[model samples]
Target: MKLMTKLSMTTLVASCGLASAAVADVKVGLIFSLSGPGAVLGEEMRNGVELAYEQLGGKLGGVDAELIYEDDQRKPDIGKQAAEKLVRSEKVDFVIGPSFSNVMMAVHRPVVRAKTILISPNPAPAPLAGEDCNPYYFAVPYQNDQPAEAAGTYMNDHGIKKVYLLAPNYQAGRDVMEGFKRTYKGEVLGEVYTSLEQTDFSAELTAMKAASPEAVFAFYPGGLGIQFVKQYDQSGAKLSTPLYTVYTLFNGAANEAVGDAGLGVYASTPWTYNLDNPANTQFVAAYQEKYGTLPSAFAAMAYDSLRLIDGSIAAAGSADDLKAVRNAMTSAPFQSVRGDFEFNTNNHPIESMYLGQVEKDENGQYVLSNQATIVEHMPDAYAGECKM
Candidate 1:
């Protein structure tokens, strides 16, 4: 009788273990601007996450993953609705993105409240980095202000004293300008905040031309960037006044749309296609091969987010446990394509920002070539304010 009971107990235990492993499928909600002004950036980010999944063999830490994508349409209300659907209906274990900061701000609270792991591949707004920081939120990219700060510092060091600033009148726009002014030791000829949907920059260009600042700094991403660059080029601004900007302005993805118009522009970014590291080299080549275009900084961040999530799940040993995943993410176990990546107390990436110049590569393609390292292992300014 004892021997028969032991055999039955072992069989039950084996069956239970098999059931657990079989039901270990993870569901992830991916929200980003699939249409509207930010579509290009969103598409690139989507591709990055998709590629990462493929490379992982459709599994994260030995558990199969199902990714549900939602289009936010670059609207805050739409983003909020999408977040609700992902959390309430789908009950996703992890959430990634809403490409722009405005959309992120609209959706962050609900995700945090649900205690779901929310990892942003882009748009690390200032508030989330500071007092509003949440234990459930992690930003795999640099803070919204970091790139702008790098541009400002670069321009200041290069003796560009007077500059004109332009951005969309939004949270990120305001943050970018504030970041620039923080490091810029120059005269601000003027600052213009245009509507997010404003396609034509003729009025802004006229004003910038009139100001005749030594340099012009602008933060227009996706379609807006393409329009701005083409208009600035047509205005003959490239010949006399230089343009110094951040990502989405002078990278391979943007240059494909801006064409020769983006030539001679200087931009600051944490990752570039030309970064000389084995991980980056493999990523750039694989990305180009799969998508038939160069991966942008946006794409790089998305790729990193997936890898980070994968490592966290492995470390935690279970994707369903939010606390374990959060604790594992805080430790940052993955290697980033950017070479050196760590998370600060604010959950923002601590990485180097590089100066890149828009130039033609050997293949005659316009790409941002890495020129120099502008900042090294720079932690976000708001991190100190974060109690987490």
Candidate 2:
């Protein structure tokens, strides 16, 4: 709540015409994995929101904003608790949550059931984009399979036949490989699913090297990704074949952690810090200024999440009607840090996807150089399956 020392009620009401009655505080809850393996991503997601709130002059929906944070610890049950608390007790209008698909699948139903808008910065599971789509849920990032599909397209277009696939034996890990195979017209040299908790990949790396595929595509995010790159480089695999992913480049530290090992690695992404656009230019500058480091795709998408909400609030003139705000968001002019944005009928994003190669910048820092546009204005494949 903001204190108005000398301002009259009329002045307060006039300044923000979003409310018919006196404008009250807007509460937004955040649920992310603030502990365990995903802490870095969760921290960045929160950082993105904080930077967004600061840039927006500390107001949301034309009212003083109240942000409540809940740490999911990268677990589904904990995430469910966070969602219940935010909905049942805090009564927050919206929740920016779900860093991982496991947690997202766990908490999505309950939060949507309660009529609170649940916005996920990452992990737009294909299930939610199709038969299970919910109007109350909004995925700020591209659909989980979108980038993977783009990677598959890149390989197919470039005629990279005989590729090996690897990922953690989890929902998101499986989804990416599935998406890759969905578009890839290539020989599957081999397919490997590793344990989510597996730290060392000596066995898997040996197996991949034996297959001797033209290329390798793997989805081992978080610390696992960092480890995978380092191991792949050490296993003498990088000398023979290249590494590709849709996950590693999204995290800022992954580049630094892998360092020279990451060179020549290609990633498929929807947003990169290098995108040249008015919004992106401003965001990259502001984010670096505020965070004292380069922003990741996780941060970019979260920052865009609030910006879209701000635009929706302005168009709807109030957040009292949740559906109205959602309608305004979808139908309104979609400007994002990624240039243009649109939502499919299922509330998934319809946007351009790109292929980026890890290269050194002028400062000798590792950066994902935009290689080419893999897919433009690409709609998710499951859009047709969505009843909504």
Top lDDT prediction, candidate number: 1
For residues 1-388, could you state the per-residue lDDT of candidate 2 as single tens digits?
A: 0112113223433454433222446777788777788877877787787778777766776666656678888889989988998899988888888778888998998899998888888888889988999888888788888899999999999989899999998888888988898999999999999988887999988888888899999998887888889999998899989899984444576678789988989999998888999999998899889767778888888888877778888788887777888788775344688986788788888899999988888888777878889989998888899887
TM-score for each prediction? 0.93, 0.92
Poorly placed runs, candidate 2 (over 4 Å) = 1-24, 248-250, 332-334
Tens digits of lDDT, candidate 1, 1-388 = 2233224323443543432223548877888887767888887887788778778766787787766788888889999998999899988888998899999999899898998889999898999999999999999989999999999899888999999999999989999999999899989999999998889999889988998899999999888889998999999999999888887666546788899899898899998888888889999999999888888888888999998889999999987786888899998988789988899988998899999989988989888889999989998889989996
lDDT, residue 31, model 1: 87
Candidate 1 residue 188 Cα shift, in angstroms, is 0.7
Each prediction's total of clashing residue pairs, residues at least 3 apart in sequence or on different chains, is: 0, 0
